[model samples]
Target: MHDLEASLLGGDRDLTLRDLADRAGPGVRPEDVQLFWRTLGLPYADTDERLFTDDDAQAVARIADLERSGRIDRRTAVTLTRALGHQSERLVLWQVEALVEDVAQRRHLDDISARLVVLDRLTELAPVLEAQLVHSFRRHLAAIAGRFAAEFAEARTTEQADPSALPLARAVGFADMVSFTRRTAGLGSTDLSAFVQRFETAARDIVANAGGRVVKTIGDAVLFIADDVVTGARVAVGLAGELGGELEVQARSEEGGLTEGHRGVTPVRVGFVQGRVLSRFGDVFGASVNVAARLTDIAEPSTVLTDPSTAELLAGDSRFVLEPQPPRELQGLGSIAPVLVRQA
Candidate 1:
């Protein structure tokens, strides 16, 4: 048992399921050891005898401690473990894809050979990369664990509510092109690619120039969550105007003809709203994102639709003309009254 305990406590290389069963004593069968791991939601399939890492053993010990302390019900613990496993799988897959793409692009290698090289290089660099990734992953996990631990303790202490609630902040919004998929559908792959690139470049510059951070781009949409109403409003209006103007120019250049709404090109619709948001994992969530996206869907090409709250924020701004549209029913949000804004 002492030997088993020492081996299990040491690190990745020395730990094994055999050590665990030995420490668990004579009556604890190999199946029992394997079942214990399964309870923690690890994706590992355990034979009657299968090896385990020290990290696995340590995690199991922590879960056991929680059970002994009555901190979590067994069912809830199982659910949490499963959720963590799913998230880990997603993060791993995203990172792997990112790394593969990065290596391929950097080396300018063709597909088949690039994949082979990626695997070969990964094998050679596994030790160093693993150590670094483990360190970072553990730190992030510890932070999340600490937050949950604090929340659990608060929940236990308070009858009505927990004091360790998530922090709140000011407004957020997203800007997206309307009918972008439909509009680009008629375009060939090369033209479609150019159009998308132009949209991103214009949106990014306008957002940054207007004092907002481009959180990320999702297809035809760009999510920009600002710390305050002013910043969010600025970003939305700037993006709409700049992208609209650029599209007009690009359209004229392409067709070599001038007409109404074709002074230069077609334009994109943008939407903005101001509300609390949940920022997580390089993404923003909450009603702000939803409303902004939905509004964009309904907006006319080359227009900006803003919620009442956002309109009020820009009430006195001269750079835009905000014209109120009648109250309309929207999915999920029911009835909403918004205003269209355009550069005067």
Candidate 2:
């Protein structure tokens, strides 16, 4: 076990948990170190157990420095640590599993052998993946900074706003693939992967071109946001129309297997609403977000639906023809009428 630990960590194997804490220097509280460990999703180790390395001590020291400098409070530190832990854990699992599956299929190997292949490849892949993550994060951070700058400049021109109020009033929406489970039933890995990739890529392109941002893509749906209602409406309408067109084109194409006769194509339904939303961790949440999701569930394929409030706001738009749908009972939301939006 000690030899394995030495080989894996590539460091002295005699440092206990308490020894690591002591190496972090003074003014780093015991509780703070424990909290950091727990936030990183690590189980508690006995204080006397040699389970940590010098790198771990350095990380704790860096976190302590950040906290001491007032750059991050205790709560924020925990949140940051937890986010890193949770997101990285999921990402690492996903990447490793994808690699294992590919190796298993290509080499006709058993599961254990495939995993061994993954382990062999990980050392070569880790640094590349880390660099890519950092590069992507920097680019994303730049975009976020630019957005905030533009938004703050706009806010300065507004009248009598509370300084502490959240800065953005955005439109949030959801677009869900209809009959997803039924459509993808009995599909092999390659076919299913292509289908989902096609949908997500198309959805993202549609949203971006319509001046909206895709917040995230779920298996059979996407969540998006835009700076204003008009942009949001355009995104919702474009997603449905464009996806529908893709399906039609696929149905007409003479490709084989799943691509034949729209066997791989899926129709999408969209719902959008304009309101103030709370943005946290690159995701939006609020009543409007819930309403948008609910509306998408009730929308028909290749169509867009909006709440009455949103419809009222968009009443006079010439590009859209709005039709009133009968009010129906919705779970959790109770009875409500939704407006069907058609592109003119």
Candidate 3:
């Protein structure tokens, strides 16, 4: 066995499934152990195969301790395990791919060669990357805790809010990139990667600077949320004006014309709303989210739009002008007047 693999596993893979269950202490069923493996996005293991290690046993034991102590429920434990598995899977893939791309770029290697080089260097890089991941996890956790505190420090009881409606009253928005498919129809891998990374980086930066949280970046759009409508308005306007306008000017510039890279792919249409939304599984949902998306579809390039209800809320704010547009029928959302929002 490789030394680095052994170091990571805490020993050779000498333990069988049965051995793992036995070492996990009392009340740790073998089936539950299998469930744990499955929840970690691994396949079910044979009972007699020596495919397990001390690290596996230790993880099951620790979770067993928590369960026995009543600190965590079995269902939630599984969910939490799945969360770690899912997120870590994506995170590592993204991190590794970025490393491969960087290495390929620097050394002028092809895809397979870059991958081989990356595989050889990963064990050495793993420790450093793991430390950074821990640091980032801690920082993000602290930020979430801080947000929770600020949100609930002076909150009203649940019953005081509309019982039938979604619990959280948030500002939801979407910024849809105009004609994304048309813009990059035949781009190669490097160009495509750069295009996506650039958009995501810019969108995330805009959301953060505008007091909004990016829910996620869809392939052709980004979803953002803010604590209040005004903040969401700022987010919406920034995506439309700052990001989209930047692209529009690029499309017309000497270096950014269609003959160059797809710098001509310009402008994003933004839409936002102030309403109750159900926040779950790292995304938001509700009428507001739906309306925001629908409005984005109808918005012109480099423009921001909102429902009348949301616009009315921002109407009193001096930072924006609410231009009322005629009612338009949105698929599954009925005919609704879209109001354009722009900075004063």
Candidate 4:
């Protein structure tokens, strides 16, 4: 088990904190290394502990060089480092848990035995998994770059980007599974896993087909975003058309859209709004996100609702039909007339 550490970390963990700091670079300090580790959600090592490796030293040196060369400031550096810390931890855990489940099932072992087996197998699997992680990360980076080039190519070079304004002109919303607790109340582990996995799988396909990106899926809900309103409208209506029913066209009319589903088919209510959103910590924030969530909560099962402004944007598009629902007072957002979106 101790030897596995060197294999996974790319070298022996032979350097103390002070030794690693001096070895990192001329500008690197012990505190800088501490900051990086701390931001990565790790506990501090004792001053004399040899828990770090050359790979760790290189990472610190790289960050310090970026700061020294004015390529990145401390705050930005912290943000980037923290992002890696946050996502990397989740990614590794997700993979490891999947492996644990697989091992338990395949070996006919209990969960505890499976976990022990996984610990023994991890050193063998680490390199392959690490390669895939790097490859997938690079592909995502390219995808983002393509979005920027295609979306911002016509913008004036002299125009200053508003740092305070919600950065992306996005369509953000949540699609929550209707009657989630009631539906899953009696399911066993395998059944629940299948249910949730089915929703996420289908939701991902729906979002991708509509040219939207799924931000993340909560246990019983999915958060999605699109570059513009039309695509967003497509995503919302698509979600409804595929796995939902129609809601009232007017304000709370008839309380419709809720319908029965066959086994394996889950109902969802979607709501999205077109507005600027603050993208941070790998998720979105701001009023638009809140409003969208509010609209979703108010929405009948299988319905897709949008705020009045988003409705107006989609109103001009021939692909969708927007019905003006009367104004409803939404919590935190005051009075907003929700619009029901339908495919033409």
* Index of the highest-lDDT prediction: 3
The order by descending TM-score is 3, 4, 2, 1
Question: Candidate 2, residue 149: CA error in Å?
Answer: 0.9
**TM-score for each of the candidates:** 0.56, 0.84, 0.91, 0.89
lDDT of each: 0.66, 0.82, 0.85, 0.83
Q: Mind giving the per-residue lDDT tens digits that candidate 3 earns over 177-291? A: 8888887666656766877788888899999999999998889799999998999999999988877644421122334223443335458999899999988667788988989
Worst lDDT window (10 residues) for model 4? 246-255
Candidate 2 lDDT, tens digit per residue, 1-344? 45544544656656766776777777775666778889998876777877677777888888877888999998898888988888878877877778887998799887899999888777677778879989988998898899899988887798855656554689999999988888777666655665776788889999999999999898999999999888899999999988875442232222333445443456799999998788887578888899999999899999999989999988888988899999977679999999998888
RMSD (CA, angstroms), candidate 2: 4.4
**Candidate 3 regions with alpha-carbon error over 4 angstroms:** 156-159, 246-262
Q: What RMSD does each model have against the real structure? A: 9.6, 4.4, 3.7, 7.0
Residues 9-60, model 1: lDDT tens digits: 3544444666665555445445655656665445454443444656665666
Listed per model in order, the count of residue pairs whose N, CA or C atoms clash below 3 Å is: 4, 0, 0, 0
Which runs of model 4 end up more than 4 angstroms from their true locations?
A: 157-164, 245-262
Sort every candidate by lDDT, greatest first. Answer: 3, 4, 2, 1
Candidate 2 positional error at 220, Å: 2.3
User: What lDDT score is found at residue 324 in candidate 4?
Assistant: 84
Q: How many clashing pairs does model 3 include?
A: 0
